[model samples]
Target: MIYNLTYNGIIKVSREHLSNKLEVGFNTISTAFKYMEQSKLFILSRNRSGKTNCGYRVILDMQHVNFESILSEVYHLKAYEIAIVKDEFKQPNKYQDLAQNAYISTLNGSNSTLNYNNQI
Candidate 1:
């Protein structure tokens, strides 16, 4: 969902909708969003004004060329290279020699979990 949302250059997200889609609790989604925001992967517009969210802007993925033009036109967002982050988060190789395991680089931020955006 995150990948698709970012790739599509759509930034708005709702805890309720994400909760339903991911079959998780609203609080769980909220917590995840909080973590992402803290990690700088997303910029959240937090609201304590009763169960309503103001949505968020996902950290733009510059390596994903498909979204650049769309994002510029839609949100006037110019995505800058995140400096070695995008390449480090790509999916694992589909075909690797069984004898040699390629290390899949993990996404590291100030305080974040292992990023598996490739799968999401």
Candidate 2:
């Protein structure tokens, strides 16, 4: 949903809007937004007066994400399996950069770590 919104150049959003679109409660959307912000996937800012919407800048740069580690840690996938899946991609370099950035982001302390390796 966020990716779609970002793709459409819609950065500003409200909890109510998301709630209605996702068919979820407002607080659930708020929590999800907060989690995304903490994950560095979104930059959230408070709106000015008379506005209920919040400014959300979705971070779509693949270089900043670590798909390998995320899949391994979060989804319990093996490195070899990840390698196989990555090989299926037409442009595997993109995934390689994402793996590298995971190491970079961890060293830079920009992302939460879950047993990330020191070597890239």
- Each candidate structure's TM-score, on Cα atoms with residue i matched to residue i, is 0.40, 0.38
lDDT of 1 by residue, 72-95 (tens): 565555455432334444534333
Ten residues in a row with the worst lDDT in model 1?
A: 93-102
Runs in model 2 lying further than 4 Å from the true structure: 5-10, 50-120
lDDT for each residue of candidate 2 in 1-120, tens digit (9 for 90 to 100): 656544542245667777888899978987887666545433355545557454443332122255566447644779888787556543433334445545423556676665446545
Return the clash pairs for model 2, or none: none
The TM-score of candidate 2 is 0.38
